[model samples]
Target: MEKSVSKKAEQTLKKARVKYPIGVKLVVIITVLLLVSLGTITFLVSAMVSSDVRITAEDNNFTVNRRSATEAENKLNTVRSNVFLLLDMLNAAGSSAALSRQASAFFFERNQDIAAVVIPGSLELVNTRFFVSNEIETTLITLFLQNEAAAVRRAVAGEPLLINAAPVFGVPVIAMLYPWQESGYEQAVVTFFSSEDLTESFGSGANSSFMVNDQGDVLVHADYNLVRAGANMANTPIVQAMQESGDRNLQLLYTDQEGNRFFSAFRKISIGDAAVITSIEYNIVFEGIAATTRRNIFLTAAVLFAAILFIWFFSKTISSPVRVLAAAAGQIEQGNFEINLKAKTQDELGLLTDSFVNMSRGLAERERLKDTFGRFINKDIAEKAMKGELTLGGETKHVTIFFSDIRSFTAISEKLEPHEIVGFLNDYMTRMVRCVNDTNGVVDKFIGDAVMAVWGAPISAGSPMADALNCVRSALMMRAALLEFNEGRGGEKKPIIKIGCGINTGDVVAGQIGSSERMEYTVIGDAVNLASRTEALNKPLGTDILITENTYNLIKDYLIVEEMPSVTVKGKEKPVRMFAVVNIPDANDIPGAGAKGPRTLAEVRNLLGIKAPDMNKVDTDAEEQKYKIQES
Candidate 1:
């Protein structure tokens, strides 16, 4: 027993040749596939999110810069308009004394951030309060004169010009002025406001605002030192980007002289030579991005951890049972039929485990009975009987019966030893049974060296014509099987094997027969008898296969057959016609050659010169009434 089990184990190992078990492989493969899928999705999502964040940040920078610049421009324009309105009001007053009174009133009423209004070419005080001394006005006039050429040129071109850090009472001020040609003189109303005014108008949280001249000179800036000192930042990437851009607006990333990177949006306002610039430190702008990235990383890590846990749990839940089943199957493979699996769940895997347990019991029982019943009946039929497909009852069904017998089997058996006879019979029966089963015919029984098979009973091939054709095919295959069997026995001094087959199609009773304790599934009635009688005629007709008129009619179009004599049998008064099946020709053999009645047969015979026997004389009435019983 131990040797037997060891040999079975060796056979299983040789068949599978696997290095590792299925559970580990399943877990590894599933984990790898899932990780690859999720990893790809995460990468793509991260890339898209990062791109959108950058785009949104840049767009927001543009919006903020443009808005702040517009606000600053509006403030400057209001101050210049007030100064111009005062000048016009003084001109309307028609006297220097009335102009002085109007200027005094306007200066007192206006914002304190506006220092004084002056005419550029003549250095005339267009508007001033009592607080503005002659010396302070004179100093402002001198600064305006120093930069008068550039400012006047811009003013003459119908543009507002702003001068950064003009001296007024030794204090830095932003000077914005407009020019008009009055009395052939280029006169202008210039407003001087502190840099504090510009800073207050454009200040923002997390960002800085500044104005730069065309020479990249820091004009109005929150840092008073840069404004007072007139710092030059001409080499800055932000200024260079603006100068290179044709749209007069630019958003860029720049690093300052201190090597601090920043994101900057700059717009050259139409009001002056100055461009309004808004800047946020790179750290400030990327703070949100960093926070989002950290959140995403944490989320991705959490998801990956959860996925790992799920994969572990899934592997345990699914592979544990599968591994158990595999181990149990290995035991069964080693010839140990005792297997009991506890399937607690109702899933497919649990059902598979339950099936394995039942199969082990079934295999054990089959092992105990295979030698006894399997020799009498086919293993397939014996198993079906055990499965309750065969029972002690019968039903009349349309069936095609097949019968095949070895030619001169008794003489051949007499020449061989008992063991040799068994071997020869096993080989012959195995091949012939394969042919019958392959063609969907059920082997009813074995009668010595003969086989009885039927189609269309119990499980029909769907139709009578199909069953009939299958019966003829099975008969032909059995003859071919015998020829092949003979070829394999080339070196032996044994007789070459030959088989004769016959088939008939009709209604027959098919089911279990004999005693209740030892029943056998079979077919009975006249159809089965006719099949046997036709098989016996094969020896006299010198043919391998013959079919009764009923089967011949069903398969005549597919097969090349010759008509034989119509013989009266003991069963009925009618003579039964039989045909010898030579071979199936082709798919397009004879058209409409098998459709009932005399017309098809007449056309077949007339076209193919098929010889039909004369249906001449009748035997005695007593001989017809002999009451010959057919086998059941």
Candidate 2:
């Protein structure tokens, strides 16, 4: 028994010579896919959030700068217009000096930011001027006239000069003066007021606002100390951008001198040489987004870690069962069919493990039976039985039946020794059986030197038409295989042989026949009987193959055949038509061959060394009475 098992093992290994290289497993593939999916999602979300925050910051900067600039310009315009109104009131000549004094007091009351307003007399009184403030009018006017000499000269020379800042006043002061000469005398009005309110309503909270002169001097700023110091901001990015830009307003991102980045905006203001600048730090702008991104990254990392761990453990559940099954299969290969596997979970892996256990037990029983009875069953029947698919009784099937016999087996057997005859029959049966198996037909049995086969019963080759085609194809294959088998043969021990095949297509009952203890899988019906009778006619007709009317009808277009006289069977009243097989046109798709056979019966008889029967002898009635041949 051990020797038998070992020999079987060696045979199985020899048959399983083909091997393929292993590839990457599911765990790694799934892990890589998961990482890519999470990473892509995280990156896209972070990018969108960052973009939105940056845009919002820029918009805020632009809005703050524009609003603040408008407020400052409105304030300055109000102050300048009020000063002009005072000049106009003073220039009204029909009014008395008392009226002019009263009008100046009213102007000073209405324009409280005006520090002191000076109105020059007409050309007759060039040295004479009216004062809007009684207390500091003379001192402030003298200081501004002395400190800003160029400005004073410009105002007197008929040029309206506006000075936003006068350092001599030691306050936020806006000084404006204009020429008022009706006669050609050097006379003008000068007024000074605080610029404190210009920026009072601008900068607050995270956004800071400031104004820079064309020279880049910090004129009005949220920081009072910077304004007082007259900070030079010529090199600042916002200041430089404002000076260079042709736009009325602009916004961008920049890093300040301190290397702190900000979202900043610049707006050109109406105030002399000044523009409003608003800025908010980049960190403050996108801090929320940054924080969110950090959280997302952390979460993604956690999810990735968890997914990897899960995939690792999950793959174990599958691979472990597979490994156990593989080990069990190795034992089975060594003829040890006993298996012990306990499925732990309720997943597919568990189901597979359970199925494997059942399969091992079933294989063990089959092994025991085989040891008792030997390799005793047909291959097809054994396979179906092992798979628990075989059942007793029979089924009605549309099938193609085939029968083949050696031309002169009895006379050859008489000449040869018993052992030699057995050897010869075995060789011939092996080749013929291969043709049947190759065409997917089941060999029903071998009787003496004759073989019977069936297609479309154990399993149909799709339909009756297909079975008929395969049946004819198998006969053609036998023709080729026989010629090859007889390549170098002759004399008594190795006689050159000829075979005749008959095919018929019709309904039959096909199944495992006889009692369960001693059974055979075969087909039985009139189709099988007709096929046997047809094969017997081949020798007398000088044909190598023949088919009944039923099969000829099925594959008439595919085969090149000649019609023969109809035959009268024992039971049938009608004469059944028969045809002699010649050649199948281009039978490609058959393994190792095609319709490379005799195209004419003369060639077939010549190849097989058979003389054609003389049809003019007139023995049709006698042939019918003796061999069931009839001319229709």
Q: For model 2, what is the C-alpha lDDT against the true structure?
A: 0.75
| Segments of candidate 1 deviating more than 4 angstroms | 1-87, 90-362, 367-372, 408-427, 460-466, 487-497, 585-632
* Overall local distance difference test of candidate 1: 0.71
Expressed as tens digits, the lDDT of each residue in 1-632 for candidate 2 is: 99999999999666444332112345466667677757766675756667777777788778888888888778767877887776677778445888877777787667777777665433211112223332234465566667767766767787765564535555666566666664456677676766677657665778888877677877677777776666788898888988999998888888987999988898886645568888999999978877777777777777777777877876685677788889989999999888788977555566567778889998899878755543344566667766667667888999999999998788889999988888888888888988888888888888889999988978778988888999999998898788888889988778888888988988999887889787778889988888888887787787888999999999999888888878776667788888988778778665323456566777767876778886555355544543456644
Clashing pairs in 1: none
Q: For candidate 2, report its TM-score.
A: 0.55
TM-score, cand. 1: 0.48
